[model samples]
Target: MKKLQLSLLLMVFLVMAGCSQSETTNTEVNKLKETNKTLIEDYNKLVDKKEKLEMELDTYKEVDENSKHLTTIIDDFIHAAQKGDTATMQANISKEFTFEKQEEWLTAVNGEKNFPFYSDFYKTKLKSWYLQGIDYDKEKDFVRVFARVGYSDGEDSWYFEIIKEDGYFKISDLQYET
Candidate 1:
């Protein structure tokens, strides 16, 4: 009887040890799952942040691409006008170019109206155009330029706009502002 009781006690102890080990394993598995979940969440947040940063960078590039160099176009306009080269002017004007007649266009450059006001203005003979400025509007698909022309009298600023065509640039508009 004594031996039988000892055997029974040993069996109970062994069962208890087995149960404890099983519980420990379950706890460890739960911990690993929780760690994996947290890591996944962190990775998702980082991806979102990276996407936002990329968008902001793209915005900056668009603004830069469309926003500089009015002078170059203006120079083109002056040269075209002085040489009376309609082809050269067309090269810088929008295809659907709109303004009054050429006279009205010239008047604007002279700042005869809403155009800016500057004293000592003179028309360039347009022997050769030199770029003075360039400006663009990214959203509008248009660009403006400023140029110096060699007029019979002297040099002056001429502004013109280029229209976007078939993923290319063309002269479609012209104006002169002081």
Candidate 2:
């Protein structure tokens, strides 16, 4: 009877030990699952950030391409005017281009009155003019070109404003620095 009692106590201890081991294994599995969930969440956030950066890069590429094309157009127009090519100059001028003069105040000259002024300016002031630099404003959809202009007496700097219209870039305005 004592031997049988000892055997039963040993069996009870073995079963309790097995139950404790199983509980410990279950706790470890729960911790692993929680870690895996956090890693997946972190991976998803990184993927989202990468996608957003790619989209922004694409937008900047498009803007850079457009700016290059517009710069070429401006260069061609300046070259044509320098060579006294009226047809090319006229082609690059937008119909909506306004000829404005501001000495003390601003005044909009009629096209009929403006043509002669433009002609004289191009023929005389722009004879030795050359483009120095160009800047673009994507949000405003406009370009600013810096040029070295030659006057009859001396040389100076000038700026031209170009705008996009009907899928083409055209000279919209000119401003000379005093």
lDDT of 1: 0.58
Tens-digit per-residue lDDT, 1-178, candidate 1: 9999999999999999999999999999999999999999999999999997797667556535754433444455555555454566556554554323343343222224333222223343345556666665556656666565554656556665666566545655555533
lDDT of 1 at 174: 56
Q: What is the TM-score of candidate 1?
A: 0.42
The alpha-carbon lDDT assigned to residue 19 of candidate 1 equals: 100
In candidate 1, how many Å is residue 40 off? 13
lDDT of 1 at 27: 100
Cα displacement (Å) at residue 37, model 1 = 15
Top candidate by TM-score: 2
- Best candidate (score: lDDT): 2
Our tally of clashes for model 2 stands at 0
- Give per-residue CA lDDT, model 2, range 66-103, as digits (tens): 76665566666666644555566667777764445444
